[model samples]
Target: MSDTPRATRPGKTPKHGTGGRGAAPERDHLRADCANCFALCCAALPFAASADFPVTKPAGTACGNLREDFRCGIHTRLRADGWRGCTVFDCFGAGQQVSQVTFGGVDWRAAPESRQRMFDVFPVMRTLHELLWYLTEALAQPAARSVHPAVRRTLARTEELTRADAATLEAADPGALRAATGELLLQVSELVRAAQVPGRRKNHRGADLMGAKLAGTDLRGANLRGAYLIAADLQRADLRFADLIGADLRDADLRGADLTGALFLTQAQVNAAKGDKTTRIPAGLTRPAHW
Candidate 1:
């Protein structure tokens, strides 16, 4: 709803444990660990008064629902209370990284003077972590094995950047890093899609298909990067091996849709869409509870 790329649902503990600082970044480290975090996402990200959020909140201001222990006071009823966006946001473990490693485990409340800076650095770190998530996924694609070395090098460099101090992180350029990594991911997508869906794949990159009646469409191996598919009726669509990087899937119906092996499909995208138990999602992503 907020259009932010999420990793996992908030207020829920991830199944994996986090590694210590200075260790190599792994998939586990890319997940949100609310226990080690200071509720930064609740304080840093601004929310508009929309269907996703009932109240208007500015950046750097703590949410009214955040409790003393940095947990959501209404965690059990966020959606019922019109805080659906919070459930969809994950911060991709950026909250803990900024709270523990970047700020040396010092919370903004304990060091009030550092609050603004911490809030400023949170989004920057989130971008780096999100890129790391995509790069990690790209590295795991067997069809993209040819670019694994490049992906590894880029991932290593990105991980090193995440270890920088708060000031360095706030001043870092995630856009440039994203561009470089995006090219490699494009190559990976091409390799994977080509191998998975042989001939005459759909080319709908960046198309405006909002609310289009696309139910049961054979869109396997389609190039849908940056496409606007909001509120589209995609029930039973064959999306296997499709490139969904940066696609807006908000409210798109995915009931019974086959998304197996979909490239660059983030949990945030899936969570934002409409789905059911029959939807076949890619491995490593959980079905939205609302589904």
Candidate 2:
């Protein structure tokens, strides 16, 4: 038997509603159940053969690796196989929305006719869910508290769109969803970037800049604690006054970066950086003795 690690999810709680401020702190929002979905994105989206994704699949064709049970056949060996991209990617709660609400919990095996319906819902639901992930993360920022009220409202609005019925989800104008999400993401970016403006950048607390390209940038007074920065490109960047507590920095490029005043960066993160001895670290972060 393959010693593959499968996610054993027992009592996993998905967000039933967006937690407004004053609500109880939410438990973790786990990876969505793809089996519950119609496997819509997998069937509806197209992938080109590239370094990031080695295989090219056309729209409407399920990934060859996807089993009839709506699971990835190569789940355990994603990297060993050509599916490393899928393994690293997270759909937040999109897979669940597309599976349950959009399709009313119908699967291809149950109703072959629903296959086309699943395709119709995939693109729309994916876009909304992606925005939800960003907006949800943005709401967690303390330094951005001034904008928290607006951020929370926007998150709930976007979350509502994902839960719309099929005819509503399908007939809904894609332009509207794109425009709203684009505006919100742009606002969040502007708020973060404003602090990086020439000698005038404001601070961001616990913001989400995961997988963002911030090469050779200045990020002084930024509060980035508990952010998901996996594989983010921060080469030669300045990150002074940044809080990095509990942030995931795996495979993130921090070479030639200056992290003076950044808080809560662990020794493990320092070791993960492709930095030279000359690289500057914040007082909060100490170089591993091994380094």
Candidate 3:
């Protein structure tokens, strides 16, 4: 929801639309190829003392737990060690792209002068990749066929920007691009949401629903796009056919919630939220191992 793509573990790749025509190719580049990356997320980004991070780290500074090999020293113990943020952070594959492609495989450690450039370009690359993720999703929406041509062109433009040089990437304004693509996605969402019948309409786009009690609510086919559901009591809520694109679900209780057919529910959101084994999700997305 921060516009920064969320991170997922190696084995937990995002499962896109089922049998979507002209579905984008496998997003291997959008994934965190840590082996090929120089730990851009751990080094270029900053973190604060919170439930997700153990200590405060300044931007462009390497995290204390970062290893010489560009892996976290306590990677396996991140959650237990009060670094829950690391577990939920996904770069959408910008780390490896900037490391291997933009910088020609030169690492920040070896070239100190390039470190700042690498850090600056990393976020730009990430934003572009995030746009790619959305555009690909738009193309997969058969219901939004009217906008597929524009979506395809936009996707191609974003892909070209991702392949730009470091200078171009650093100078690129991705917010404007995201704004333009967001308009198209909005149209797509309208087309998709129009088909579903809501038991009770819940138009809480970007609304603050944190800590709100909504247990056993009939939210079938509700549009909860960009809703802030942090720490909300959603126990046993009927969220079937709900559109949850960009919803902040951190710490939202999902025990026994039925999310079957919920649209645009990312793995990152699921990983950040609270749930139990009884919670039902759509097919293709496996429940987090930690949950």
Best by lDDT: 1
Candidate 2 regions exceeding 4 Å error are 1-14, 20-30, 188-198, 201-236, 239-291
Summarize candidate 2's per-residue lDDT along 1-291 as a digit string, tens digits: 011232223233345555554442232342345544545556677778864367799888887876666666676666566554454444445656666656656665577887776777777776666556556555544545667677777777766777787777788776787676655645554554455434555454455777889888777656565667778898888886455644677667787788864543544566444565656885524453323
Flag the better candidate by lDDT, 2 or 3.
Answer: 3
Which number leads on TM-score?
1
lDDT of 3 by residue, 77-158 (tens): 7788888888787777788788878888778888999999999999889888877766766666677788888888887788
Using TM-score as the measure, what is the rank order of every candidate, best first? Answer: 1, 3, 2
- The TM-score that candidate 2 achieves is 0.63
Q: List the global CA lDDT of all models.
A: 0.84, 0.60, 0.78
Order of models, best lDDT first = 1, 3, 2
| Alpha-carbon runs more than 4 Å astray in model 1 | 1-25
lDDT of 1 by residue, 1-291 (tens): 222222322233323222354232358778777777788888888999999899999998888987777777877778888888887876788887888788877788889999999999999999998998898888778888888788878887888888888889888887887788888899999999999999999999999999999999999999999999999999999999999999999999999999999998988899889999999999978898899
